[model samples]
Target: MTKLERSQIDFSTFMLYRLAEHWGKSVPDTYRILDKANAIDGYLVPCYDMLHTLGSEYLVNDLTDYVREQGICI
Candidate 1:
């Protein structure tokens, strides 16, 4: 990938980490949810589009709720 794409992936991963920490979840678990919700053709959605479409707060909240309801302790 290009440097810009790599940077965006890093930033997106960091955001996922923050979201996981905020919800007391493992990063992998959080990633699974994000992947399911936003992945396209085995890749994550672009960071800008993801943030614009779902917003960080809403995405975290929705994933938190879903994880809690599913009782996914990991």
Candidate 2:
């Protein structure tokens, strides 16, 4: 991919990470939901898939840390 595409990938991954936190959805489940949406709307597929695949584990880890840090006591 070009530099811009790669950059966009990184940004989109971050977006998905935040989105997962916002919706209280896990990485794997977010993929299933976004994958379906992307299927119905092709334009979002690349970013969505990249986010779902590339950032999943990291997002989960980051989210765990965030929750722990916040001390929400969930």
Candidate 3:
């Protein structure tokens, strides 16, 4: 599929997969930290990790990089 078509899909797995593949990062086995939690909880997990452990700026960098590398249109 073309990049435009691929970007139209609503699959978090595929979006993250494309980013990780492009970046050559060791993408985790699972995207969600908590399988049972809601999106707010899941989003907060990463937010907390960045804020306390890696710093908030790193989180912004990560998000920016992910978007740039993934070509995630949504």
Candidate 4:
């Protein structure tokens, strides 16, 4: 894959695992939650340019808020 593509994947992976840990859920479960809320594609990936610059805690919190706002209990 191209470097940019790889970077995006890496960042996504990092956020996935980080979120999983933050939410006390498995990676797959966390992924499901985000996916169900459309946070993964709709927000996370699309906002990666700005999201990646934030801290891990902020990212997790932001994601949590995003998911919650989507009306999914995560």
User: TM-scores of the models, in the given order?
Assistant: 0.54, 0.50, 0.28, 0.92
Question: What digit string (tens of lDDT, one per residue) describes model 1 on residues 1-74?
Answer: 98767766765776688777986779888788666655322333344445535566776665556555655543
Worst 10 residues of 3 by lDDT: 32-41
Residue-level lDDT of model 3, residues 1-74, one tens digit each, is: 86633433333344345434544554462233212223223343334433335443554445544444545332
Which candidate would rank higher by lDDT, 1 or 2?
1
lDDT (C-alpha) at residue 66 in model 1: 51
lDDT per residue for candidate 2 within 1-74, as digits (tens), equals 88766766666566556656766879666555555445213433344445455555665555444444545322
List candidate 1 segments past 4 Å from native.
39-74
- For 1-74, candidate 4 gives per-residue lDDT tens digits of 88876777899899999999999999999999988998878987788788889999988898899899999997
Model 2, CA-based lDDT: 0.53
Model 4, residue 66: displacement in angstroms? 0.1
Local distance difference test values of all predictions, in order:
0.61, 0.53, 0.41, 0.88
Which structure among the candidates has the greatest TM-score? 4
lDDT of 4 at 49: 87
Question: Which one wins on lDDT?
Answer: 4
If ranked by TM-score, best first, what sequence of candidates would result? 4, 1, 2, 3
